[model samples]
Target: MKITDDMIDYISELARLRLKDEEKESARNEMEKIINYMDTLNQLDTTGIEAMSHAFPMKNVFRKDEVRPSADRDDILLNAPDKKNGAFKVPKTFE
Candidate 1:
């Protein structure tokens, strides 16, 4: 697709960018080159290639989740500077 001055102006407005006359021309030329390169890529053949989410193979590396005994609640509450109703009390953050 060809990048026109009007298209550049529209994009600049959407991006909330204020470009000088020279910068607008430069952006238009850069956008045209990018689109031309994309068009060239569209000519490639990939009939039997499998689509991948990433360029490299990936695998989950998580440890097994196992149930374990937890520390006593009273033992934990003993260390708190402030406690209320068996829970740690914190200052109100919002109204």
Candidate 2:
């Protein structure tokens, strides 16, 4: 389906976008081309092809979780702009 100027205007309004005339024209043509491509894809026959989550082979690539010694509290708190009781002290917003 070809995207019309009216469709572009409606889409822009719906999306709260302020597209220029040139931008609107460009978007309209791109959208029409995408719709045409989808229409073409609809003509393809995929009776036996199984739908897979990924296009390529994939495997779990996770590292084993392990406990490690962390830096001392003093070392971490040294960089704080305003710290109190080994924690950052920001100004309270509420009364």
Best by lDDT: 1
lDDT of 2 by residue, 29-82 (tens): 999998888898768898999989998899989987999889999999998999
The total of clashing pairs for model 2 equals: 0
Judge candidate 2 at residue 1 and give its lDDT.
85
Clashing pairs in 1: none
RMSD of 1: 11.0
CA shift of 51, model 1, Å: 8.2
Model 1, position 51, has a per-residue lDDT of 91
Candidate 1 lDDT for residue 46: 80
TM-score of 1: 0.45
Best candidate, TM-score: 1
Worst 10 residues of 1 by lDDT: 37-46
